[model samples]
Target: MNALVDVSFFPRAAKPLASYRKFWAARFGTAPFLPMSREEMNQLGWDSCDVVLVTGDAYVDHPSFGMAVIGRMLEAQGFRVGIIAQPDWQSAEPFKALGKPNLFWGVTAGNMDSMINRYTADRKIRTDDAYTPGDIGGKRPDRAALVYSQRCREAFKDVPIILGGIEGSLRRIAHYDYWSDKVRRSIVVDAKCDLLLYGNAERAIVEIAHRLSRREPIEHITDVRGTAFVRRSDDDTRLGWFEIDSTDVDAPGTVESHINPYQTTSEQAAGQGTTCSKEDQTVRPEPVEGQAEASTSSARTDAGSGSKPLRFMPNPALPQRVGKQVLPPRERTVIRLPSYEQVKS
Candidate 1:
């Protein structure tokens, strides 16, 4: 079953990946393999890599590999990209192999979630990892994203750590862990990383790299889509953005109904005002004070009752209509998701 919440807001126009001016170090040609050691960096004629990528998979120069795709993309944009694959997680020593990144550290748990790669459907520990050079297991620690991020922090106290790949993406929000048999907090909180990029991260990652190169602080770059981060609940006040209660779309309460948009109009009308029994509804957290409420407009009135239907309307606080055209101003808005406490219950 899928859970959803209605969010009505306009995001600013996204800058194209290739639109940003290339970093100053584009003069250094691409490395056949993003360097895993100082020797490789010296061979590539690089004094220091602008971005260092740490992954749990072996270095394969294939597009299928997350590290390769991201590294190559950044290199094309004129940033020195390096790789530290399958570093020993026993201590922070191996993490220091690439020295400190001039921009930030990109950490991923390889192509697969570490837990799934290391375990079986029956929860038995596996003995092989196909992505590894020798098809070996135990190369990456469980929750490799979190472990690697911590190591990066320890290696360079002030460097930013950006977490991605399957592990960080899947666990970006509170999720039930089959192996752990409990709900886990968002990896953004557990890993203590600066940012978490989910799904196809090329767009967000490119923008982030350029912004950081321009010296924009990571904390101030929160409006990017397909990304999640930890911030105080009260942080939205300064932006003057309205909030949408998740429950407005998904009912709050135990045993909530699943809404299927594909259902027939008659089926929807039949289920109206009655709880759905097929799927559980996700609970939304309560709205905080000082946030604007969603707008509403009157739809058709019921013939029998002579009462108008309350329909969701676009936020009037946004760009106003000029004649028949509505133009939205670039602004930052937030869709409030269920709190970690709510999801756990």
Candidate 2:
């Protein structure tokens, strides 16, 4: 009924979630649940879905299921969405059931990582999958995100693929894979998906769907938070990093008990009563670099000299309270890690 909305519609401080105008499909009202097959879609009198979500879990209409949450969320935003859950990955026929989406294909490995779902913590094959309808195992393949992305590409070669869910997000970059017993390259690079949305992607996904509906290219939608994309080899994206040492962070200065430890029970009991004695004291370590002075809040110090820890009572919250914490700027942070080439060698 109204014009479409973009990121700049709302104030910088306010969330633009519900601010976007609803898609024209809002007039179609809601389906009983997101259609799982073309028959269901035909019954709803829909020629094609706006966005089709390909997932490795059964399509439960509950919020607890990742695909359901995403599907309903987009539906609420007025987009005609469909689901292709746990489809037979052997052929692209299942993927084409809902037909090609007008916006893009959202692919996820469901709630849990496929490898974790198919195997136990010890890397033994698992016999059960709680997410599956039958409470059985092997509904989805190992590295389900990669497999599903490839299939989506096969079904609709011109459509953009958006890789998501725990399976893909966890492996966004070169990381160790327990099942394969080795490190693997970034899932986006391997899947060749246009974008990868990580973490709680409600906001990110909503924006992406709307942008795609407006015919914005997914590759150029890189500035959206929570989304990651592979860069062209010619692109010069500079990276910077600063290290935070655990030891340097605020901590209970090391304990140097002035009292003897190998004492008799009688001697220890006697020492407990004399809490005010100066001989029964602890000392503070030198201040951490950049810290103007050592923390004295947890210990009593002599007024005359530098921090002379009279007694040490650790304050667990010291780390949060003392440091000049600097959060990396959003949309510009770059993590530095060893290249897969070096790590493999």
Candidate 2 C-alpha error for residue 325, in Å = 16
For candidate 1, write residues 1-345 as lDDT tens digits. 111211223365767887889899987766677888999899998888899999999989998888999999998898999999999999999988878899999999999999999999899999999999888899999989999999999999799999999898888877999999999877888898888888888888898999999999987877777777777555642365445545554432234568897997556866785445443344656655433232112222235458777765665555443454332333554556776788999
Best by TM-score: 1
What TM value does model 1 have?
0.74
Off by over 4 Å in 2: 1-14, 235-337
As a whole number from 0 to 100, the lDDT of residue 241 in candidate 1 is: 48
Global CA lDDT computed for model 2: 0.78
In terms of lDDT, the best-performing candidate is: 1
| lDDT scores in order | 0.80, 0.78
Please estimate how well model 1 matches the true structure, expressed as its whole-model Cα lDDT. Answer: 0.80
- What's the true lDDT of residue 333 in model 2? 42
Compute each candidate's TM-score over C-alphas: 0.74, 0.69
